[model samples]
Target: MRGLDDHTYRKRTAALKAKRHDCWLCGDPIDYTLPWKHKMAFTADHIQPRSKGGHIYGEIRAAHRSCNSSRSNRVTTVTTAPKTALRW
Candidate 1:
């Protein structure tokens, strides 16, 4: 997250709010009303990731703090188990 200061983060948050975009890591809605430190609060996400020499800009997207942390620097898919009927 180098080069991505608070100013850039604010801009990304505003952009996401304006467009009403969903978090890339999770499909849940981001609650901008919450404080930035909140888990569900809006945060900047790097699509390419910063750990793999990926810059902190350009490929950036909006996401929730929890989502970004869960996703980390790698791509992942999250899903729930399918419901099943109980035997009589």
Candidate 2:
């Protein structure tokens, strides 16, 4: 399959950066850098895996390489519990 050229990738990356200011998964700040910089490597992750009917460029989140890898294909959610008194 054909992949996006460097120019097209840059444009798309810039637009996505403008829309979301941080890593969508962990809420970490995104570092904008030159293409050659080591920190420039970022992954576009699917909020829901493609195997589960997710589409390319559909519901994506930008994340650091490590964070993206660690979060691979898992559904994340935040839950709250009622407060209870504790006994010593």
Clashes of each: 0, 0
The 0-to-1 C-alpha lDDT of every candidate, in the order given, reads 0.72, 0.60
What is the C-alpha lDDT profile of model 1 across 12-73, one tens digit per residue? 65776777566766666777788989999888787777787776555666689988898888
15-63 per-residue lDDT for model 2 (tens digits): 7666645666666666755342344346666678776776555566566
Model 1: lDDT equals 0.72
How well does each candidate superpose onto the true structure, as a TM-score?
Answer: 0.66, 0.56
* Cα error of candidate 1 at position 25, Å: 1.3
Q: Identify the candidate with maximal lDDT.
A: 1
